[model samples]
Target: MVNQAEQIDVPCADAIMRLLERYGFDTIFSIPGVHTVDFYRTFPERGFRHVTPRHEQGAAFMAYGYAFATGRPACCMLITGPGLLNAGTGIAEAYSDSLPMLVLTASNQRAELGVGRGCLHETKSQHAVEQQIAGFSHLVLDTANVAEVLHRSISLFLTARPRPAIIEIPRDLLAAPTRVTLETASMFHPPAPAPEAAKMAADLVAGATRAIAILGGGCRRSADAVLELIERLGIIAVTTNAGKGVVPEDHPLSLGSSLPFEPVRTLLEEADVVLAIGTELGETDLLYTCKPYQIPGKLIRIDIDPHQLTMNFHPSLAILSDAGLAAKEICKHLSASVSGADRADREKIVRDSRAKLVGEWSAEAPKHKAILDVLAGSLDRDALICADSTQLAYTGNHYYPSKTAGAWLFPNGYGTLGSAMPAAIGAKIGCPSRQVVAIVGDGSFLYTLEELATAVENRVGIPIVLWNNRSYGEIKDAMNAGGIPTIGVDLYTPDFVAVARGFGCQAILVESLSQFGAELGKALSRDVPTLLQIDADGPSFAELAN
Candidate 1:
């Protein structure tokens, strides 16, 4: 309980704490340093859980994973200068997927802020550099104004275009006694949809004879609405990498989440109307410069951010509104012009498209089945899985069927390596009831392996599955594709099993494909965290992409 007597003379940093609790943050992922140790010193007694990851980058990724696992904004506190810069990769990844986060940074005193006095943790343009990747970046120049700045920054985390927001506070203010006006945190209520845009979107999709609904990460908040619209309008649904499993893939009308794959491309080609929902049809999703995406039909899009409406393909009708509200409004106004006779044609289109894709997977069943079986056996249908950027991730993301929006956690937008382990640990902490797994490559796993210590110290058990390819497989494949010899890409990894055990996790090394499932089942069933290193020497993803 916060004491009124104590709050009467609360330091600005303590006032910030009161504001944080008011805004619904119970835990903060952070790494303490000289510049930010004062706040850490008083942190534990203030009823806040401080999770200290080994590295600043891991702490940032942990915050991202926590936010993804729980449908709330996560916070990461770091020292200024190097600490803030180290967190750039994770911040960039979260920005790409539009995840909500709060990054609290401690800067030099307000007087020496940009004077280049060579003060500890001093950097010029720290706020500017952070602003480039963050949704909003601001400085708290005064102790009295810290509460207001925190309130504003927290609110932006819940806005329609939710992403990470950075707020830098000067060290001098942290301990200074100040009277800051702190109000009860306002529940971040999103803006309502424009009535006219909703009506127009309803008219566009409700009347189409054959409509295809494409979902992206923006659709996460409206999974139910998307499902309802799909069932109501009898339209086909396909998800993007960022928006995977917004609608359960088990539905008959569902085409599994894969970007620009053959079956989904066919659906788009034949679609009389395409309802692009909550995703910016970015270059990667469209496989642009490889083969441009041309919509031959009426295109309608619903998105919270207006800028994305025409980021890539021009939409015939663009509705700037919350995805859930937009979907419900479209459903309400929709009465498909498609008749009972046209129903057969629509159903056939969905069945044939899904069947063709399944058939292709079946053709390559021998190669992928081992990995799929182990995943199926080890994790619950709704388990949360983190994917590092590597060749292995490309395949799992394309074929893996996630039942819920947050179940598949990939660095979809940033495509960064070394993200899966720390993010996986954060996901476990965020949702302790659910099983969490990190699927990573040997090359990528080495990047954040230090996080294993963080995981063990925190007693967060996340079973990690490493594709031990012993090389930067993607780069090697790219080199071979261009008819160039492999150079610096080939890697030499430490014994991962020994490394995992040394870090206090149950470790298993499986060489044969047949033993993969059994070993995984054992690891996942255990209460403690585990790591299973698989000897993978398959054809590169470049071959699979072909």
Candidate 2:
């Protein structure tokens, strides 16, 4: 393989590396298979620091975590068929949460089509799995014009509302030579401002007595704009789990996260007008379900993608614009609409929300309270936390608070299980100096338990805090709600302490509240990777709901 710096017309793999360099992707996480020979060979020449994951899924999740931490898409590569199959969960997580990522895979030659000859690692269709994920993906197939496809694919992947996209290069395409022009810059463009759209939003806020802003994934990208908008309009703001830390939770007008909480529902019901910014208000964020067209107030929605405007809830006004730019413009127009008294009232609301949250955490039982307290104390103010799906997602989003934008990352869109471990590994790799933590539930942890080895191999050293409740807590709650007994959701698992030790990382199992502080302190202070497993003392969601 020719070096990336040497401007030689080469195969699709070489061209892809050139494109990656142009996009400033210096690190790549992958689990190479026989199908990706050319990509593996070209990585070193391209000056990419490649981390070989133990599983393809681990690679994908790691890329997702890295993107969340650094606000830049990380590249992932896998072989076709089984490789792509294993990577499905990570790709889905990236898709659902709008994480920017490039997934490159090698497919069998076009000549090998449908010949029940059954080639090694062959699938019925290379692109089928991606199609299943299409609702959340921006996929592209590269059958011809590899360079052009690569350019366009990268462009779409970087656009506002960025999501995972695939470029399937066939075996023959990698072996064939092609004319290549060195790209001086990435083909992708930065999102532009939406001033006109922002003014309209400002007008809607001006006419309302009680306006509430619901921040989602898109708002995280423009935290400064959101903060400015809140300051200007003096409106109460609440974040969905994915949108946590878009603005400081401790900020006067910020209501923290509102998922799985009765207070948030009450607040929404009381508002005269609801401004949903950058979030789709999806099913999971709305407690697994919500009544359509039943919101008590006018709904004004703003998002970078037009498709998200009317989902779940109808909107009085919908605007397609970049979140940050829209927020900035709205702030600019809100100067005349907000009075001094209104600002004071908004501040009071924020105070009340904070006081309420503080009260809840303080009143929690010893075990759950210990987990929350240890996490808050151990995590650096600027450290990044990547939470997995299910109970961990709910608990972390509600209890933990982050100080900066992109500091709290999680899989919110698809609500896929088992994202925390791999994502934490990726985030650690992306920002090696910052302390990264993954909060995961037992059910979610089982989905990607093998990635623990990848973390050890790469020395990514992220502390994984497993909230071991010994059951699929969320599903149990649902079953109980429907008057069914908890059956399939409960599982007896191996001690996570032993599991972490077997994987050669520091491990601790804390069952008592008294042991919480020591275990957390040791885990966070360690130079090597650590896993702190805590046995949560509480009724399963089933018991609580029943």
Candidate 3:
């Protein structure tokens, strides 16, 4: 409870805390340093939970995970130069995946910013360096504009395309005792669809004999609208990795998030009208395929960003609106024209595509499928699975079927290594009631392995499925496929189970595929995180799968 006496006049840093509370920011992830220690001046008064990670990168990734899982932005407080620099990679990954985050850092004093008097944590121009990663970076010069600037950042996250926003605060203003006005956070609505464009798209979709809809990350909030539109139009649907569970994979009209596969590409080639919503048809969405996407159809694109409307693929009808609003507008115009006759044919196409894709994946990577199947069956409907940029996650991006939106989180665009463990910890922190797990590769797990102590200290009961291939398996495969000599792919590996045990986590080495389910169940009920190590070249997974 905030003291009534102290509310009259407090430190400038404490004033910022009150504003953050008004904006509904209740949690912060940080590793406090001398420069920014004052930022935590009123944590006890404001009732904000502070999670401290070993490194600044872990802090940023944790913020990303919290935001991705709950669809709300989290705050990160860091020191000056090196602290901000350490967090760049995670911020960039958040930008690539369109996650909402607010990063606050201490900068050198305004007088010492570019003067280079060799202050403790001085840099040439910290805000300039950070501008490249965050959606926008601002150097706060005065205490008066703090409320307005923070309001802008929160508004962008709620109403526009979500991305990380950075605020660089000078050290002098942090501790100054001053009075600042706190404004109420307003409700900002997203843009609505244009009627003419919606009508034109409805006509094109209604006239097409064969059509398909591709859902992307932008459709996450509008899953209900997306489901309604697809069911009304009676067309087959697919998703990009980011849009994994927008349309449940178990649905008959759903083709899963298999955009990179040949079967989906073939379907896209034959489509007469393509409705691409909330996703950029970027190369990352169609991984492993050198063949360019050929869309001879009339493409209708709906997105909030105007610049993205003409990117990569040209759209016949481009509507600038929120994905959910645009979908509802299109469906309003489409109800009379579409019939129920084509749904059965579309379902058959999805089934055939699934069969062909299963045959291909089973032949190429049976172990990954076998592992994913077990995980899918073991978890609850609301379980959050955080994946890293590893071979197993690459396969699961398409092969795994998620039943709910926001359930599957992956670092697809930036493709960063060692993200799964920290991200899963953040997810668990954000939604304590739901089950959370991390699926990471041996090569990527080492990137942030020190975070195991953070999980153990916080008692985040997360299950980490470590795929121990003992090398950079995906890079080696790519080099072999290209007939290039393998060079830096192989490396020495350590005993991960022992390492995890040393960090006070439950650890186990699975000898066979059959033991996975029982161990995972045990891990979920424990007080600390668990590390389950599985060898990629171990006992045959095909035998159990068959």
Task: Say which candidate scores most in TM-score.
Answer: 3
RMSD of 1: 3.6
Better of 1 and 3 by TM-score: 3
Clashes of 3: 0
Two-way lDDT contest, 1 vs 2, winner: 1
Cα-based lDDT at residue 292, candidate 3: 58
Q: List, in order, the clash count of every candidate structure.
A: 0, 0, 0
Q: Which one is best on lDDT?
A: 3
Candidate 3's residue-wise lDDT over 504-544, tens digit each?
99999886667888999999998799998988766754553
- TM-scores vs. true structure, each candidate: 0.92, 0.90, 0.96
Model 2 C-alpha lDDT per residue in residues 1-546, reported as the tens digit of each score = 123444567776777787788768888888777788887666667798888887888888889999888888788888878888888888887888888888888777877745656988788776777777533332233424766666666676556678877877777777577767664665445455466766777887887888888888888778887888877777888888788887787777778775445556667787888988888887766553342224678888888787888888889888877787677777777657478888888788767756664323322233454466667776788888888775655656666776677888767667778888888888888888888888888888888888888878787777787888788887887798899988899888788888889988988775554455667666666656788776655333222222
Q: How would the candidate models be sorted by TM-score, starting from the highest? A: 3, 1, 2
**lDDT (Cα, tens digit) per residue for candidate 1, span 1-546:** 222332356887777777788777888998888777767656776687779898989998999999898978899999989999999999888888888889988888889977998998789878888888998888887777776677788777666688898988888878888785545466666655677777787776667776888898888877898888877777778888778889887677788675466777766777789998888887656421134456789998878888998878898887787788887776767655345656566677777876676533323334444575568655787898898876666666767778887788888777788989999888888888888888898999988999999988988877788877788876786798799999999888898889889989999876555566677767666656789776665434333222
User: What is candidate 2's local distance difference test score?
Assistant: 0.74
Q: Candidate 1 regions off by >4 Å?
A: 1-9, 286-290, 335-344, 358-366, 512-514, 538-546
